[model samples]
Structure formats: C-alpha cells, structure tokens
Target chain A: METLERLLLGHPFFTDLDPAIGRILVGCARNLRFAPGEFLFRENEPANEFFLVREGNVALELHVPGRPPLVIGTLGAGEIVGASWLVPPYRWNFDARAVAATRAFGIDAACLRDKCEADHHLGYEMMKRLLPVMVGRMQAARQQLLDVYGHPGT
Target chain B: MNASVAPDPMLPQPWRVQAVRRETADVVSLDLVPLAGAPMPFKPGQFNMLYAFGIGEVPVSLSGDPADASRFVHTVRAVGAVSGAIAAATPGTVLGLRGPFGSAWPVAAAAGHDILIIAGGLGLAPLRPAIYHVLANSERFGRIAVLYGSRGPAELLFHDELARWRGRLDMEVEITVDHADPSWHGRVGVVPGLIDKVAFDPKNTVALVCGPEVMIRFTVAGLRAAGVADDHVHVSMERNMKCAVGLCGHCQFGPDFVCKDGAVLAYDRIAARLAAREI
Candidate 1:
C-alpha cells in the first residue's frame, strides 16, 4: 500500500533509500505492538531486530548501580529503535521499554542482512540511510551523560 | 493533496532597522521599520537576519510583540563580530532585514494550556516576545512560568524585566546562575535542575526554550522526563548564518534549513538532527 511505502520512506533509518529498495524494505517489515511498560529488548540482549515506531512512545533506559534507571531518551512515531543490529557488537546497549501502548514495524535484521548480501544495491541504500541515525543517537547519548547528575569527585 | 503549496509572500513582509538600543552591557534591542512601508507580520518565536554595514548578518529573534506589526524588535547578545557591531551601533543605523522567519511558537495551539518558558543565557531574547504575547493575552492561557539560567548575574539579560515578571501575580519566574557570585542570592545550577523545583502540569502546558545548544539538549530531556510531549516542546536553534533567506547552506540542520524551516522548531521535529553533531 502507498501508506506503507510512505511510512518506510518517512523514517530516518529508511528515508533516503532508492524507491526500489524502499519497496523491498516495506516487504520485509512486519508490524508489532507492545503494551505499556513492556520491554522491547534488554541490555546485552541479541539485537537481531530493528524497529521503526509507527505509533506511541518508547523510552531508552540505562541502568547503573546506586543510580536509578535513567531514561536517557524517548522515541516516538517515525523514529527507529535497536539500530545496533546494523553494526558490530550486535547487542542492545540499553533497555527499551514501551512508555505507552506502542505499535511499531519490526524488520528482521538478519532478513535484511541476507537481502543486502543478495542485492548490494539494497545494502548500499540501507547503509546510507542508517549511518545518520546511528551518528545522531550517539551524539544524543553523549549529551545525556553530560546532563545526568554524577559525583563531581569522579 | 496539494501539500506543497507556495508560501504566502504577503505574510512575512520584510523590514529594515531604523534604530538600535543598547539594552545592557552585552545586549542590544533593535527597533525595525519596514522598508516597503508594509506591516511585518511575525509570530512571537520567529527570528530575522540583521545585516551590518561591513560585517555580515546573523539571525536574531523578534523580541517585540507580534500583534503590533508596524515595527519589529530584536534583542541580540554581543557574542561575535556582527552582533558586537549591532550592539554598539548608534540610532538611525540601517541594516538589511529578510524575515519574520521560521516556524513560530504554537501560541494559538497553546491556548487554554499553561505556558512554560525556559531560557538560558541570552536564550531569553527569543523567548521574550512569546512571554509578552502570552502575558498580554493572559486569559487565553493558564498559569505562566519562566525559568532562566545565565553564566552569572552580570551576564543576565533583562534583569529589571525579570524582576517585574517575578512580581506579577499571573506568572512565576525563577532565576539561576551556572556559577554565581557572593552577591548572587538566587538559585545556582543548570536549568534542568530547576525543573524539579517548579510546579506545572506538563499535560496542560507547552514549553518554549532557547539557549546554548548544550542547554537546549539538556532542557528538552529534562522536560521530557517531567512528562512533556515532544511536540509540545518548542525550541529556537542558533547556528552560523550567511543568508537568512535559506539560499546559503550555512544554517542547514539535516533536511531543514534553520533560517527558513526554523530557528524555532517543535522539539520532536529537530530532536534527532539537534542530537547529531556537525549536522
């Protein structure tokens, strides 16, 4: 459907793809829903799935001992989550929890990876689209750490 | 659907600076009159570029009321060359002006909602016009709160106005300093830390923020944690600008031009790009 194509093309992780590749991406994606407070994934878990939120809120939480679980950031509709699957150390770095009842489109990373290997054009399109999202998230994490309260002595 | 309609050229009529006021040690407020004798219609949060004589121009927010469009007003900090010149310029100086630019604070949309304004350092300049708009149309909104943080008392802009704002019965104003002097008898810490001390219903409130890049990032996070929605958090972004008309790539932030698309954007619209460095 055109709506699915529009949704895929609107996402930052897939927005810049070649139309053919975007159509291929839409074919591989499956919509999934999570209840509020549901864990989409846990830290150090196998990051085999990447998601693009279609609706509702999700929180990216990082836990440190003595310090409470800090909500470093929140992702909503039109945002990508679990991007670690694209790069090495294919493991989630933080826990993603559904802040509200959320509906997201889950793309099997291995499926996409397999498709990429089969079609280098799709691979290049996906990579080009994903690079900016990865860089942007890392910058946001760094900014969060700077804001979090910590010991001045440390 | 005709989604890409041409912009209404009549809305953002341009103006030129007729005079400049040195508001404080480092801040200057300009009084602008339209070059074409047309009224310059700008929403409160919009900004414009002021081109100096020899030096280039920079984007400065319209600190004046949007309802009164016969003249435009801008308060600028002397951060660099162009701003320093504008701050020192005498009255009757003219500068090239090209807006009432960018997405505006959703004042009409924010009606019936409490308004929270957080400004750090010179960030107050952009948010000032919004504060005036809200206060002037007080019945349209609920409680008003302002949280401001600066480098120190010496660097705080609008000290007298802030004092007056604090005294108003309809609004609550809190002032903080990143580093304070012995004489600075006010809150001391980052603006985010002050969020816990203030009281407002995030659901019924819309927040408008402008400040240093670092401060904005932190403030948005703080607001989110306090239960504000991304769409409801508006921010005014600052970047180096050569042309305020969006032709130059100097003010590009991801897919949007900070000049034309925004100096003010919904926090959600810019959150990802703002998080990225060198974008």
Candidate 2:
C-alpha cells in the first residue's frame, strides 16, 4: 500500500532514497509485530530478514553455556536491526528478542539483494546508508570494551 | 564554603558515623553527624576531606540532600588504603572531617533551561546531591533528564532511588550498562549512547557530567556533537587532593587547583587543558 511505502521511506535507513528505489524496497518489506519476549531471529539461523523498528524495543543477545543470554545492545524505535543480512553466508550472529510489544517493517534480504545486484545505484545507496550505522555500532562497542567505568585507578 | 564550618579550615573536627549502608560490594554510604559543632552545610558539588584516624584522609563528594542539616552523607568506594578503612568503618566510628570545599554546580545559572545529567559508574555518587536539589525545585527548569551508565546491574548505586526517579512523570531517566548478564532486560551500551535516545533543546540545555576521566571526555564529545555549547556543559574533575584548602598543590588541574577553582567547572574553561596531553 502507498501508506506502507511512505512509512518505510520515512525510516532513517530509507530516508532520502529515490522514489523508484523506495518502491522497490517496499515491495520486499512487510509489517511485523512481536509480543514481549518473542524472538525475532536466533543466532546461527539464516539472516533472511532485517527490520526497521517503528515502535518498541529489541535486544540483541548472546547465549553462553550454563548461563543466561547476555544483552549485547538494545535497539529502539527509529533504529535498524540485523545488518548481518548484508554480508555473505547470511547468518545471524546473535538472537534478537522483542523487549516490549513491538511493531516493525521486516524486509526480505534475498529480495532486496537481487534488486541491488540488478541495479548498482540502489546497491551503492544501500551501502552508503548502512555503513554509517555499522560504524557507529562498532565504535560504541569499542568504547564499551574499554570498561571505562571499572578502571582500577582514578 | 559553609558559614557553620570551623574557622580553622586546616583543623579536622570529630564526626561520628551514624550508620553505614553498603551500596555495592566495594562501595558504602556513611551517614555522619558532627560530634562537636554544627554540621557543615555543603552545596551540591562540594566535597569533604574525611580522615580515617591513623590511616589517612580522602576527599569525598557530598552525596546527601542539601536540605538535610542533621547529617552529612558520603558514598565512598574502597579503591585504596584510606578509602578502604573509611568504607570498612562501623557505625559510631569517629572520623575527622573538614570542608564543604570546591565550586558548586551552577544550579542558579541553569534556571530557565533544560538540564541533562550524565553520570557514569561511581560518578553517580558525586551527582546525587545535585539531582536531589533539582528534583526538589523542579519548577525552575525546563525538561530534565538523567542518563546513568554503570558497568552492569549489580554495580548500580541507589537502587530504590533510581526506581523512584524512573517512576516520576516530570523527568526522564534512562539507564544503561557497558555490559550485562542474560537476565538484564535493560539497555547495554556506553553512557554516551543514551544521549541520542532522550530529547532536549541542546542550545538551551545545561549538561552536568562526572565519571572516569576517559568517560567524561567521550560524554563531552557526545554533547558537542549533539549541538550543546562547551560553556553550557559542566564537568566534575577528580585529582589528587591532599589539603582541602587550596594551599596544597596536590589537586592542581591545569592552571587551577581543583580544590578551589572546581570539582565542578564549565567545560569551556578547561577545554584546552583537557585536550592537552601534558596536563
């Protein structure tokens, strides 16, 4: 529907996208809702889908032997989840669980990939938009790794 | 400086520890009452030099409500010998106290503007008094938000108080941790990461930041990126403090002694000092 297309275009990932490219992306996107505690995708599973969160929160987690899953990061409204879909071997690296009743637009990765392959401009645009998100997360993760809070000396 | 403080600032007055509450495995909050004279009234960002008998003295920020005249509350982490002795003291233990030192948070100047309080790790301990004052006088400010980040859930200070603040409708409180176990349903990320989640008019907002030096650097950068001017951002700096009075150069930060010029200072005043490697 045109309403869904417009809503999808408003997402940061799709914002400023050419109308033709947006329409192509909307074709592969569908509305999704998850109950609290529902797992959107599991680690080691095929990363066939990615999402643009419209409302609510999602936690990306990792499970360890004999331990509860550790939350790596949380994504909220207006943020994108699941960049693994863009890389080769197409598999999830962590489990994403809806921390609250959530609504999102799930985009089929294979469908978008085929479109990108057919049109280099669309592929270039997608890379241009997603790279920043990846770099931001990487930098934040690095800061966390520094354990800035627990340094022994003042 | 408080008017009631002893005229001889160098002399330590005896104060009795009224009670001790364990904040974490390594941190404790000591409620102290002056045994001789009136309790020294401290502004939100000021600190006290607490002497643990034969061991030594350490400068601790005032964490209690400013309105509470009966006792002074200090939350101390057992980082070294003197702090460990203070943290291990039981109720009724007598400790020597001096001060109510350093510049206070610019709560008056911050009126009519939004307030953003960013605290990381034990930095939350020093900022708690300022938060108490702001909440007690909430009508003077615009939107208010508190963003706190710790190493994890168990390391969080003031569990019940943080929950109460979160429940209030007037202000926003977002908490995050650098890491967490599987049971944590909250956010897991660096403190600066939460800045994007909250709403504030950056140009008209005043930011108060405290934490490790490295964390403060990153947080100030985040605020700058978010459009806040350097002058509007205030930071609490920690340094080696020996004499609570400005006479001892132990607390020197850049050209100013943190004991007198700050513990709380406008970020613009020290932006060059902070950026310099030699400082």
- Please name the candidate that would achieve the greatest TM-score relative to the true structure: 2
lDDT of each: 0.75, 0.90
**Weakest ten-residue segment in model 1 chain B by summed lDDT:** B1-10
Tens digit per residue, CA lDDT, model 1, A1-154: 6787777677655655678777887777877899988999999999999999988877777777885565555666777788788877889988988878999988888888889999998888777767766765565456434532221123
Error (Å) of candidate 2 at residue A111 is 2.2
Which residue pairs clash in candidate 1?
none
Task: Give the top-scoring candidate (lDDT).
Answer: 2
Worst 10 residues of 2 chain A by lDDT: A145-154
Quality of candidate 2 docking, DockQ: 0.75
Where does model 2 exceed 4 Å of error? A15-18, A151-154, B1-5
Compare the candidates by DockQ and give the number of the best one.
2
Q: What is the DockQ of each candidate?
A: 0.02, 0.75
lDDT of 2 by residue, B171-208 (tens): 99999998887578788888888998888999899999
User: How well does candidate 1 reproduce the true complex, by DockQ?
Assistant: 0.02
Error of 2 at B70 (Å): 1.3
